[model samples]
Each structure stands twice: as C-alpha cells, then as structure tokens.
Target: MAKKVVPEAERRRRRPTRTGTVLSEGIIVDTALRMLREHGSGGLTARRLGAALGADPSTLYRYFAGMDDLTRAIGDELMGRALAGWRPTGDWRTDLRSLGLAVHASYLAHPQAAVLTASRVTGRPREIAVDETILGILRGAGLSDPAAVHAYHAFIDQSLAFAALDAGSLALTDEARAVDEEMWQSTYALLPAETHPHIAATAHLLARRMPHSAYPAVLEMLLDHVATRIGGGGGGEETPHG
Candidate 1:
C-alpha cells in the first residue's frame, strides 16, 4: 500500500480532478467526512467519493491505498481537529479534562464517521500525538510510570468507548432513534411503582436527561479517581458537560 512516495511536483501535476477540480488529501478527507455525515457509513464508497470529488474513482488511489486507509485518515483528521490549538494549562487535571472534552466533541460532531473510526488504532500523526500527550499529562500529575500507564490506558479507552457508543445512537435513523426516545418516555417512565420503584420515581428525570451523552460524566469520574489516587488535591473542580 502507498508503495512509493510521489514527489511534490508530480503530485501537483496530478492534483487536478477530471472536472478540473484541484485534489489533495485535505479535499478527499473533507469530502469523505461530508459523505459520512450526509449518507452514513454505508454511503461512503470509493465510487461515491470519486463522484463527489468529480474525479475518477481510481484517482483516489494516489492519496489512499484503499477504503480502509481512507477510513483511518478520516479518523486521524478528527484527532487533529480535536487537538488543534489545545494547550495544557500546566494543571494536569484541567488539561486532561479539556483533552477528553475536545476528543469527545470531535467524534460527536461526526457521529457516522466516529462509529467507523473511534475504536480503530490509526497510529497516524494526530493519533500518536494524542497518546503521547495523555501519557505526559498523567505522568506530570505525579503518577509513577506504571500508574501513569495504567491511567492512560483507562482514560483513552473509556473516552473512545463512550464516543463510539454515543455515536451509534446518533447514527440511528430518525424512526429508530425516535422509538428509543419514546421507550424512555412512554415505557420506562411509566413503569409500575409496585415492582420497579426506582424507575417509577426517577422516570421523569431520566426521560428529561438520559438523552445526553454520558461520556463527559464518565471522563470526570475517571479523572477524579486518578487525581485522588495520586493525592492530586486542589486540582480545581470540573463540572462535566455532555
């Protein structure tokens, strides 16, 4: 795959699409992202991407070896967006919280693409940079090497896991998603108090609130746990917003 790296001059010469549109990695990734949003994961095909770019399907091969490569590239693009202009404020917990939210927001913004790419290990520039940044933050917070590694694993995994789950719900069709929401309102919210007391009591609140993503709350919990373990007191309280 991507056997040879073409020189910049050659790449520039081949940049023009069949319709005289200029093509580059950014254009292809952006088009793919739009396709994923408009048409869902199934709608993103090489043929469709080519058509959207007004280029021959084969033209995409110059940039991406195949669809999977393109998918990983899209994932990396999300990571890049999340980390863009984000700087750690030297307070480890605050920085970690900010990082989690940024990553979560990026995925939620493109649910369809998130569903395809969240769990993947892209190892691309942005993905690797994110991993390094998380580890650095954890270690900077006074976690020993082993402990920092453990926390890094937990934090990153939890973030991506929740992103994928929430994105799956967002990617549901209008009819299907409505059914889920209706179930929360009509079925769960109206359960008999005699058998399911908790559901009956909190049903109103649950219906009102459960639609939001739980990633932010979960991330806060993880961060709090890690902070507590390392005796990182007075790290500023964080109110998680999903």
Candidate 2:
C-alpha cells in the first residue's frame, strides 16, 4: 500500500502533532530556551526536548532544518528579546551604552541560554537589525568608513565576549559559583602587601567591585576611546577610507 502524501500547503498550515501540541518556530525556540534555563546547557537534547514539547523528536525538524538550525534560532530569540523594546537614540555613546546594557541584561536573565548561544552567530533578523543599528550610530557620528567598521567590530566582539564570559559564570552551579566568588576574599584579598603590593592596595576596591559585572565600565571606556577619534575623522556617512 502506498503511504498517502500530504500536500505542502496542508503541512505548512497551522496544525498540531499526534500529542495535540501546537508547535510553532516561536514556541519551539521559547521552549528550548526555557529548557535550557531549567536544565542548564546540557539538558536540551532531542529526546528531552521532544518529551517537554509533547511531540516526537522528529517533529522539531518540521520547523527547523536540524539541531544546528534550531541553535541559531535560539540565538536569534535572545537577540530579539534584547531589542524588543529598545530603540537607538541619536547620540552614539548613549545609544551604544543602552544597547550594551540591554544585551548583557538579557543574557543574565537567561544565563544558560546565553552560555549556549552567545558565541553562536545567528545572522538572523534580530542580529542583522543590531548590526544595522550599531553601524547607523557610528556612521551618524560622522566616523569614517574604517573607523565605523573598526568600532562596529570592536563593539560586537566585546559585547559577545563579555556576554559569554559573564553568562558562563552565572551558569555555574551555586556551589561552584560560591567558591569562585569566595576566592576574591580568601585568595586575592589575603595577599600580603610586601609581596603583592598592588593587589593588596586595591584589594579593598576589588572586594567592593569584583562581584559585579564589568561590561558597563568597559562599554564606557570603549565609548571614550571612540570619542577621541570621532571629531578627528571629519567624514560623514558613506565616506571612503583614506
């Protein structure tokens, strides 16, 4: 007997699986993110995700090409969340700072998801919009092509790097995290002034500041560096490199 072939249009139409679970790309990605948060990075596997979604594992491929494709979707979801209510102000430094903070906050909110997706470039809609906004800000600042490209590169690289690092730290088990946090006081803070004068001198400040995320301060420093060169560039948007 020949297996009945379903029409493509019928398949693409809104439908549910045998388990009566309505699955869309958004729902899949959202569930994957929630699973990541609940179970940590290693917890989101095909079988487990299938069980969680109440659908067969193969049903996921109906929405995404494969796990890699789904991973990129997951990444894009984070970017979308970051940019959801965010609008870029005209001022470059102010806008960029807000963008940085928004991305970092989104990552912190979904640390396990961030750890898994932060280093993965989706090149999806949300990611492209981010690129457009950042480049727009730099070009709007009258930066030369080379300067704008450089700043854009630096901005994204630093953003992802810090997001990955901080999110990975947050993803650690509470006991592991406690040990890492305790090291500031137990190890570095206890260094003797005679042998480690610099560390010891700053130990007080380090104790006060080390537990917090440094991405905000780093963003300010990067903005300050760009400020020094923006006025020197003397080029409007679309200006060619010298």
Candidate 3:
C-alpha cells in the first residue's frame, strides 16, 4: 500500500511546536540587534521586538530574564562578532591595533546598539574571553600582573569609551550631523585668534578631519602610552620601555 505523503504546507502546519526551551536564542539576539541598529536603544522594548518577531512578548521572557538581560546578550553577540577568528600575531602593537580597529568597526556598524550597550559589563562568556585575550596580550608583552591588569583596564575602557562616543556621533541624523559640521566650521572656526591661538591654528585641520581619521591615530597614541609604561621608560625600572 502506498503511504500518503503530506503536503509541505500541511507538514509545516502539523509539525510539533519547537520546544520553547530549544528555540533559537540566536534568532532572538539577531532580531534584537536589528532592532537596535534601526531604532536606537529606546526602540528596543520587548513589546516592539515581540511584534517584530511574531511572538508574544512573554516568549522573550523564556529566553531572557528582562530587557537588560537581552541587552547584555546583544552585547555579547557583538563582542563575539568582533573577536571571531581573532588570533594574536605575537606582535603586541599589531595585535592591539587589530583588536582596537576590529572593535571600533564592529561598534560603528551597530552604532545605536553600541551607544546603548558599550558601558555594560555583563561578564558573559564571550566578554570574559575578550578580557582574557587582552590580558594575555599585555602579560606577553612582559608587564607585571599589576601592570598588565592596569593596562588591560585602560585599554578596554578607552576602546569602548571611544567606540561608543564615536558610534553615537555617527548615529546622528543627517541634518543633526550637518548642524554639527556647521557649528565646527562657522562657530568653532571663528574663535578669537589671540584668545584661542592654538585652537585657531588647528580649526581648519579639525574641521577637515572626518570622525574615522582620528580613530587609528588615537589608538596608536594610547598604545604608545601603554608601551611606554610597560617598557620601563615611563616612570622607572619597573616600567617597560620601547
């Protein structure tokens, strides 16, 4: 006897419901990420996400305890993307430069999300792994435990701080961004020559510099400071010097 074959649509309709427990957390996070990228932090409420996903808001609770929990998960997702396939090259400067640029690029790609979540310390697995990688880099550079820890703190803090700040600045609407440019060109550029001689001298250069132009240079300056402190040149013999 020939067995009846279910139609594809019928099969889909009759398929057993996904155990909520095993439902794709990744999908949830991805949706949240998209919401963040499109709407900024304020637009990421559970109800909106639920509507977007065709799931009840309560369904989100099964995956995350609350919006804060979900936000942290989103942060972890971003970190995972930033660090994916990242392997240290054993050159501290190059490794750090790569890491900083990767992070900045990742955050810039999701500026609203970055602005919302950059300061959060979720201690999620991926975040912990990033911290470990950074600490290892500093330690491999021959920094003492205390110095390595300090440098790790400074490096991570500065990276995230700048990434968030830069992302926020980039997220401004075209009109708002144009206004900022206008202020710099018209108002800031016109500072009194005698009272703000240094500012006056660099106003044109500053106005011409795009936001991205300074990130690499800023990262280099920070790394240079870290290297100086690690190389025994900054303070005393305990410090490392280039």
Candidate 4:
C-alpha cells in the first residue's frame, strides 16, 4: 500500500509546535480584533488581515466561512474581554449595575469596535454567561421568569444602544465636536422663548452638564422603572413608606 499524503492546507491546520507561523481560530480572531481596533470595522478586510497575519486568505476561510464569521468571532473576543475577571456579587442591584457599567466602559475603550459589535447578539459562551448572570440577578430580586427575561432584554438592549450612540458621538472629528458644541451654544441656546420657554429656561443647565453624565442617570432611571414594576418600589422621587 502506498503512504497517504497530507495536503499543504491540512498540514498548516495542524497545531504548530514552535509557534513561528501559527494558524488557529484563536489566532485569526485575535488578529482580526487588533485589526478592527486599529482600522475600524470598515477597514478590516479579509485580504488585509491575511496579509497582516502573514497567512493566505484561504487559510482564514478554513477557520471562518467569511467576513461575517470573522466579525462574530471578533465580537466573542470583545465579550470575553468585557467579562474577564468579573465575578458576580450577591446584591442584585449592585451586581446588575456593575455588569452594565463594565460592559459600557469596555465598549467605550474600543469605540470603533463597540460601534461594530455592540448591537450584535453573538449567543456565544460569554454572551450566554452574561444573560445567565443577569437573569440570576433579576430572579434574586424576586422577578418572575417572564419579567426577568423582559427586564434582561430591556437592559441589554438599552446598554448596547447607549454604547453605540456614545461611540458614534465619540468618533466625531475635532471640527465636528466643535460644531456640535457650537450648535449647543448657538442654535439650542437661542431657541425662541415664546415657543420653547421650558427648553430655553433649561438650556443653560443642559449646556453646562457634562456630556457623559446622562448615561448613568438614564440607566439608573431604567433600572428604577424595572424595580417599580417588579413591586420593588425604590424608584422615582419617593421615599419608601413603612
């Protein structure tokens, strides 16, 4: 019998012992992530990534079906990074708040990547773990399964939406930022008092407020609404009655 021969592709697929030219799913994903961060999602083409990694594009196809697959892998990597070193505290509010803020901060750190991945639902291990952790918190807070699921959906959706919006805003050029500022100072500040008295009155406060202050406050308000609906009643402008 003649000896069977392994193809070059299959040979490369085998794990490298010395690690000079490694070609694995993890390596592809890690490289894609770096490329994404450096070039933004728009700039991460398979050809460019393959060139950067010193591998044939076909090798990437062996690991990922296409760019979409590679993007999902990158999303999983981002999720893993966000959840790394995060352990849940028993207090439901604290745990949920921490998780939400951690995710928000992580996305902010990679705004371009966040813009690409925040809206995506990967359903990968880290994403599942996040859902489980959130459901656990809601359940601990005495929410029914349906309510917990609903709240979790709202929580995740709101967080990602806010992250995407923030990332988009943050990506503005310096001139664009100045234009936004001028809009606030000129147009928004000069609203006609007759038609928009309330807005005019609060324009000063709105202008003076730190741009990032609203996100946490809005998140707290959303949580407060969920708390109220769950009969937890710590929300809104009222003190708890004995």
Give the local distance difference test score of model 3.
0.77
- lDDT per residue as tens, model 2, 1-242: 32342443543427676577677778788889899999986889878888888888877766666777788888888888888858867778889889888888887888888888888989899989888888888888988877788888888888888988999888888899989888989999999999999999999889878878899889989898789778677334432452
TM-score of 3: 0.83
Candidate closest to the true structure, highest lDDT:
1
A best-first ranking of the candidates according to their lDDT comes to 1, 2, 3, 4
Give the alpha-carbon lDDT of every model.
Answer: 0.85, 0.81, 0.77, 0.73
Off by over 4 Å in 2: 1-14, 234-242
lDDT of 3 at 2: 23
Residue 185's C-alpha lDDT in candidate 2?
92
TM-score of 4: 0.82
lDDT for each residue of candidate 3 in 141-239, tens digit (9 for 90 to 100): 877777777677777887888888888888899889788878768887999989999889998887788534467888888898878876773343333
Per-model TM-score on C-alpha atoms: 0.88, 0.89, 0.83, 0.82
Candidate 2 matches the true fold with a TM-score of 0.89
Where does the lowest 10-residue lDDT sum fall in candidate 2?
Answer: 1-10
Report the lDDT tens digits of candidate 4 across residue range 1-242: 32233344664555542336677778877777788767877778978888877866656776666777666766666667767857777877778888888777777777777888887878778778777878888878877666677778888887788888888777676689778766767877899889999989988877777455367888898788677766853233322330
